[model samples]
Target: MGFCVESARVMLIIFNFIFWLSGVALLGVGIWFLADKNIVSYLEVVNHNVPNAYINYAAYILIAFGALIFLIGFLGCCGAIRRSKCLIGFYLFFLVIIFAGELAAGIIVAIYRTEIEHSVDKELSNSIKMEYTFANESAITKSWDTVQVELKCCGGKGPDDYMNSKFTNMSGIIIPISCCVLSDTNNMVAKDKSQCMNKVPEYYHEEGCKKKLIEWVKSHSVILIGVGCGLAGLQIIGFIFGICLCRSFKYEEK
Candidate 1:
């Protein structure tokens, strides 16, 4: 049995509403994440923590979600235009696929939360220790300053003067440094201009920062897992409802 014109029209409208809402939401989320403060510093400070992984994963997920939303919306629009329940059903099928993907990813994240937490903690603890140690050492501070000054003065000739140089020695090349590490003066100057050097060599050499980082990751794992599971469940409900709505339409036709 086919849908009565009025019922089909109403269903089509509802589908459009869902499509629009989902599409706009996805797009907004993607944009927000791209501009989010945490993501901006992702390359700088993200260690092995769940939060860091979440942030990175979330950014890409938002982008993927946005694209999926656009595709679903377009398919929904086409289904409406054709007045074909099969097409609409196909759309719902894809929705189910998306829901399944969410469920799987959420489960994986939850299952491995412990390992991720431990790794993150270690890296973070080490970073903190390096930072604190460097701060306490007066000699290291002076050397770093001298290096900075020299890097600035060398007419940008040294490695520090290179295009991606984060730290430069006096009249030498610039070196690249990681956000977690501080710039060092141990090497008088870098010979290679192309290589980007990490600034916090001492942080890598220490282990204290890693412990604190693990502590933080363990504390926050629950929230991330909860949200992931919640979103998956919600999507499944929506998918089931779509199927029921289809069935209802058929009954009305008979």
Candidate 2:
């Protein structure tokens, strides 16, 4: 029985070490996602024009949860190494709370999936109509230009979506340079940027930003879902290990 308890303690310590490492990795990824200048640059467009706060909320939640997980994992590791029942018990309690909170969040998202999708589309369209401009001076303007250049897409719905835009009347330019596409040979030349000025269908991407964005999201949805499930599974395994460690400590005390 003593040997078994000792073995469990060793295993628990190993488990906690792995959990702590994972938490650190998660925290790093969250920070990278939030703080990367390029990513944040694109987010300026969303932040300025979109009314939807969910994206920012989600990012903040990820950072907070990752930090919590890191702290909890550290505590669990120490508790396991010392065979301290109080610390292990506290770890178990916190683990359960985190698990429940995640489960609740999943449920809420599932319930509102349709509404969320519609809201995102509506907000994106509104933002495009109200905020997008040809001038690339502001963060939001630069972000939209970046999106158009990177994605090779025009307005939210299409080039026609910009017909009534303030940019058209203000600049007397029908389309922005970012919307123009050059041939492979001329693509690198600076002067090619002005070549698409009056050239409509011949030089511009036909696909709308909204459709392209939605397609991009759809393509990655599976990966995101898999990652979420994997995290939940990890939490469940942590809970199990924590409980077993706490029980082993109790057995040893007796």
Give the per-residue lDDT digits (tens) of candidate 2, residues 60-170: 555667678878888887887788888888988888887675555444334333444565556555656666666656566677676776778877767776676777777
Off by over 4 Å in 2: 41-49, 104-113, 120-122, 182-195, 200-202, 218-225
TM-score, one value per model: 0.50, 0.83
Q: Stretches of candidate 1 above 4 Å error?
A: 1-12, 42-44, 48-55, 108-113, 128-241, 248-254
Model 2 backbone overlap count: 0
Top-scoring candidate (lDDT): 2
RMSD to true structure for each model, in Å? 12.1, 3.3
lDDT of 1 by residue, 60-158 (tens): 564576568667757765765665678778878887776665555555545555555445434433333232122224332232233233323211122
Task: Tell me how far the alpha carbon of residue 133 in candidate 1 is from the true structure, in angstroms, after superposition.
Answer: 12
lDDT of 1 at 113: 54
Give the least accurate 10-residue stretch of model 1, judged by summed lDDT.
152-161
Query: Can you give the lDDT of residue 221 in candidate 2?
Result: 33
